[model samples]
Target chain A: MLSCTGYAARSASDPLAPFSFERRDTGPDDVRIEILYCGVCHSDIHQARNEWGNTLYPCVPGHEIVGRVSEVGTNVSRFRQGDVVGVGCMVDSCRECKSCRDGYEQYCEQGFVGTYNGEDRQGRGITLGGYSKSVVVDQAFVLKVPDGLDLAAVAPLLCAGITTYSPLRHWKVGPGQRVGIVGLGGLGHMGVKFARAFGAEVVLFTTSRGKIEDGLRLGAHEVVLSTDKEAMARETGRFDFILDAVSAQHDINSYLALLKRDGTLVQVGAPEDPLPVSVFSLLMKRRNFAGSLIGGIPETQEMLDFCGAHGITADVEMIAMDEIETAYARMLRSDVKYRFVIDMNTLAASA
Target chain B: MLSCTGYAARSASDPLAPFSFERRDTGPDDVRIEILYCGVCHSDIHQARNEWGNTLYPCVPGHEIVGRVSEVGTNVSRFRQGDVVGVGCMVDSCRECKSCRDGYEQYCEQGFVGTYNGEDRQGRGITLGGYSKSVVVDQAFVLKVPDGLDLAAVAPLLCAGITTYSPLRHWKVGPGQRVGIVGLGGLGHMGVKFARAFGAEVVLFTTSRGKIEDGLRLGAHEVVLSTDKEAMARETGRFDFILDAVSAQHDINSYLALLKRDGTLVQVGAPEDPLPVSVFSLLMKRRNFAGSLIGGIPETQEMLDFCGAHGITADVEMIAMDEIETAYARMLRSDVKYRFVIDMNTLAASA
Candidate 1:
């Protein structure tokens, strides 16, 4: 076992603090990563506070990881020492399952092992995430980070980036299509960028009027204040596809109504409470309402490559390790510009 | 104008009674049909009682019409006098829209005219449906019923059959796939038969155990009482596609859970209230929830042809025109075998 240090929540109500733990030694198929940056996801807060009622403590909640490979086992030929890589929401999965075999390990039938608070498939203990200084994961799950991109901005691509990219690509969003991105947060911001990068006419639907300029700067062609009834009404039956990234409760029917006949709305955000979906909205135009998880390992690499080609990276606010609680509070109030990525170098300074 | 005798609802509370009305002379693109049979749909009850709050007074509610063409206008090349024909939910749609041009007129951008309680596009008054002695419709809205199928049994095919069949075909429910049909009513019964004819391994889900035997008889490989927790639990992630024909409120998440990864559940029933959908259920496996209205004119003809080849027809309980009130009452109690078809020949006897 390798000794490691991370920031973790001792209990649901407690603040995350510096803690020491042990990680499994680099196995033959494993790559040990020195985590450089970790993007804060909203779900990290949910699991840390047990809002989803499934948190295991001391919980280290960070999945959007970008790092340099510090060590690799004998069989880990794909990843060499010092290679920059990424680890998203998953660390391991039952590789024998259909989803795993099909390159969609995120939807593995045996349940993909989450990066934090997830039971390690190898029986090492609960998997600790990138809040730590280092992590050891199987080579199969590590994604190659493209060159010439800001690694801090690339962190969120593991979660927010892949969450939006997979759906847009799966639904075939491209030129001559009007795409709508609901909310302008961690996921939505990336959604706007990707939708625009995919050669689509991107519309950003945000309740915040302040996000108008930012949404446009992020590549949205139009930004509609969703609170404006008349503006929303005008967009009715106009969208070819909509990517909803709002985790907060909102009327999904309004967005569902914006789709053209046979259009689709894919939700990447998982609202705690079930949203009341108007069947009439779907039935009226044969519209579809679907949801997507982060992404598969192969797709995640594809997203990173696509981002590299398009010069696409999440607009991020970097934070120190010790300021996580403050970041969490600000995140709850929707105060971040987009995402908050923790610089792991600050971990030792906090200690 | 042609004088006609029919049963009409003068007010929301009034039971349908004998009334005199008029039909326009067959126009250049029209086909005049002497009604032989009209199938009762649950929507008819909603319209007659103004439950949808949009019903026009003296509503003649019936769209599932199977009859003989009594007259055809000068330009009506598809049908000749005395030809068997059918008409479903829609009477006319703006043929210029993309949806209409794509042969999906039911999703017409201009709003396809409902056979009953819909404002006509040609300056005619609110259209009265096929609860009458005759109806004159545009040739584009009329369908040719096959020669061999029982005409009375074919009445419900106009609405219930097409409603179920369209979604099944759209979702590609076929051999090697496991399909689920929710409910055991008019639409559900037709859904089971069509799913079976599509060569799928069919499972019927119903709240009532009494329908188990009937569900199997109607081509279901298995009948699982949806209310039986253990039975329903065993079906988790089992279906490739599920056609929900239930209009009543139920736990939609339970059904959503039954879908395999990337599976779809299409709703054809219009439940009065919005269904609460767990975003987690859809997000976890990337499942889809969609809705489909009744099929287009061309697809309706295709469905008729498909049924003609498969020797399929709705199992119907025949009733006289005067027994509509009793039929509606029994329908409310879910007492009909599957559908209730009004024998238009009995209209004169009731008068």
Candidate 2:
């Protein structure tokens, strides 16, 4: 067993604090990563507070992981020590399932093992995630981070990036298409960058009027205040596709109304309560409402490479490990510019 | 002006009764039809009773029309006197819009003119539907009723048939796929027949156990009571596509869960209220929930042709025109076998 240091929440109401745990030693297919930077996902907060009603404490919650390979087992050939890599949302899956065979491990038939609070498929203890000094995962689940991108800013790509990118790519969003990003938070900001990079005419629909400038800076061609009924009405039947990154409760029908005939809106956000979807909205134009989880292993790697080529990285605020709770508070208030990435080097000093 | 006799609703609370009205004389691009059969749809009830809150009274609500051409204007080439023809939900649409230009007049940018209670585009008056003895429609909106099918049964094909057929065909439901049809009524019964005829393994899901036998008689390979928890649990992640034909309020999330990864659930029924859709259900398997309105004019013609080839038509219970009130009452309780087609010859006797 390998000794590990990380921050964990002891219970639903507890603030995350320093803790010690152990992970299995490297197996033949395993790669041990020295955690470097971890992006804070809204889901991390949901799991930490048991808001989703399924939390195992002391929960070490983080899935937007970027790290360096510290060790690799003898059989591992795809990665080497000191190689920058990533792990997002899943650590293991039943590779024999059709989804896994199709390279979509995120939709594994037997259920992909979540990066945190997931029972180990190998019968080891519950998995601890990237809010830690180290994580050992199967080489198949590890991702190669491309060169020339800021590592901290690349962390959110693991979760937020892939979540948006997969749907856009799957739906074939590109030139001559009008794409809408429904929020301007962690996921939405990345959605704007990717949609623009994909050569689409991008529009950012945010409730915040203050996000107009930031939205343009992030590559949105136009920013529409969603609260403005006339502005929203003007966009009706105009969008070819929309990526909704809002996890908070909001009217989804309004977005559905904006799609052109045979258009689609992919929801990557997991709002706690079900949204009331007007079937008429979808029926009127033969529109689609769908959801996409984090990308498959192959797609995630493709997203990373795309980001590297486009020089696209999430707008991130770097925070020390000790500042996680404060970051969470700010995140709840929608105060972060986009994402809050924890710099793991500060862990020891904070401890 | 052409004199017309039909059953009409004076107000939301009034039962449909015999009335007399006038229709525009046939124009250059028009095909005037002597109405033969008008299939009763659940929507006919909604419109006549103003359940959708858009009724224009003395409302004449019927769109599932199969008729004989009584007259044709000089510019009409598709039909001549005595030719069999049909009209579904739409009578006219802006031919220049992208939707109409694409042959999808049902999704016209300016909104297709409803057969009943819709303002006539030519500025005559409110367009009365197929409940009347005659209807004048543009050549573009008229469909050819193929030879060798019961004309009465074919009436419902204009609306219910196209409504179900469009989604199944659009989603590419075919051989070797497991397709589920929800609610075994006018729409569900046709969904089962079409899915079966298209060579899929058809499963009918109904809240009532009594419908199971009828589901099989209607060509379902399997019938599962949707209210049976154990039976529904056994179907999780098993369907390739599910056609939800239910218009009543029900838990949509449960059906969303039954889809395999990338599987779609298309709603053809227009429920009065919004359905609460869980994002998690859609996110988990990357499933799709979409709504398809009645098919495009081109597709509707194709559907009729396909039905002709397959000898498929709605299982209809023929009724006199005056029985429409009693039929609507029975329909609200879902007591009809499948559909009620009003025999137009009964109109004069009832009057």
Candidate 3:
């Protein structure tokens, strides 16, 4: 067993605290990496608090992982010691499923194992995530972090980045298309960058006037305050595709009306409640309301490479390992500029 | 001006009554038809009773029309006098829009004019539908009812048949695919026929155990009572395409669960209230919840041709023109085997 240190919630009601655990020794196909940074996601807060009602504690919550390889098993040929790598929302999936064969391991029929609070397939206890100082992962689930990108800023790309990127790519958003990014949070910010990088005419839909300048700085061509009926009405039937990143309870019909005929609004964020959708809203325009999870491994790697090529990375605030609880509080208030990335070296220093 | 005798609702609270109205004289681009049969659609009842809150009375409620061409203007080259023709839901659309140019007139950006209770583009008056003795329509909106098919049964094909066929065709449902038809009403019956015709393995989903034998008769390879939890459980992640023809309020999430990864559940029926959808239902499998209106003019024509080639028409119960009110009552109870075709000769005899 390899000793590891991480921040973990001892119970649903407890705040995250320093915890020590053991990771499996590197298997024949495994690559062991010393953690560098892990991005704070809204879901991490949800799981840490057991808001989704299925938390396993002491829960070490993180999935957006970025690290430097320190050791590699004998059969790991694709990576070497000292290589930068990442692991997103999933740690492992049933490899024999058709989805796994097709490289969409995130949607494995038997359910992919989550990075944290998930049953471990390797006979270990519940899997811990990237909040730790070190992790042992199969090479197949580890992604190559592209060169020349800010490592901390690249952390969110593993979760928020891939969650938004998969839908844009799956829908084939590209040049000459009108794309809309709903919300301006961590996910929406990346969506704007990726859509802009794809050469699309990007429109940012937000309720906050403060995000207008940041939206443009992040690559949106236009920002429409979604609360303004006149402005929203002007954008009616304008978007070819919309990426809905708002997890808060919102009337999705208002957004559905913005889509052009045959257009789609893909929800990447899962809210606690179901959305009430007027069938007529969809029927009249032949529009689609779809939802997409974080991407498959192949596409996640593709997104990272695309980000590297386009000079795109999430705008992030650096926080020390001990500040995650405070960061999560600020995140709930939409106080972060975009994302919070934990500096795992703080865990090392504290250890 | 030409006088026409038809059955119409004088007010939302009133039942069908004999009414006299004027239709325009046949113009150069017009074809005048002596109505033979008209199918009773659920929307017809809604419109007649102001259920959708946009009725222009006296509402002559019918769009699924089959008739004989009694006269053709000089510019009407597609049809000669005595030719059989059909007219569906739409009357006219902006010919210059991209949707119209692309042959999807149903989704015209400027909105297509409805056959009844719609603003007339020619400034004649509110357009009236086909529960009448005669109709004069532009040659562009008139479809050719094929030979060697039951004319009465073919009436519903104009609306219900085209509505179902459009989605099946749009989603590219074809041979070796598994298709599910939700509900066992007018539209679902047509979906079963079209899916079976396309050589898909057809499954009919119904709440009524009584419809099991009828579902098999309507070309479904198997019928599953959607209310049976075990039966529905057996069908989880089973369908490639699900044509949702249920207009009543039902939990759509259960059916959404039945779709394979990347599969679509296309809603063709518009219920009174919005349907509640869990984003996780779509995100888990990358499934789609989509809506489709009646097909475009070109596709409707293609459907008619396909129906002709495949010997397809709606399963209809014949009724006198005066029996429309009674039929609408029965339809509300899901009592009709599929559709009711009003025999227009009853109108002529009463006159």
Clashing pairs in 2: none
Best by lDDT: 1
Collision pairs in model 1: none
Q: What is the C-alpha lDDT of each candidate?
A: 0.90, 0.89, 0.88
How displaced is residue A69 in candidate 3, in Å?
Answer: 1.0
TM-score of chain B of each: 0.94, 0.94, 0.94
For B1-351, candidate 2 gives per-residue lDDT tens digits of: 112532222323432433335547788988889999999988888888887777766777789999999989899887999999999999889899999999888999999988888866655556778886888888988999999999999999999999999999989999999999999999999999999999999999998888889999999999999889999999999999999998878999999999999999999887878999999999999899999999889999999999999999999999988888899999989999899999998887334
What are the models' TM-scores? 0.95, 0.94, 0.95
Comparing 1 and 2 on TM-score, the stronger one? 1
Model 2 regions more than 4 Å off: A1-21, A349-351, B1-21, B349-351
Deviation from native of the Cα of residue B107 in model 2, angstroms:
0.5
Q: Which residue pairs show collisions in model 3?
A: none
Which docking band does candidate 1 fall into? high
Clash totals, every prediction: 0, 0, 0
The best candidate by DockQ is 1
Alpha-carbon RMSD, each predicted model: 4.0, 4.2, 4.0
* Per-residue lDDT over A152-194 for candidate 3, one digit per residue giving the tens place of the 0 to 100 score: 9999999999999999999999999999999999999999999
Instruction: Give the winner by DockQ: 1 or 2.
Output: 1
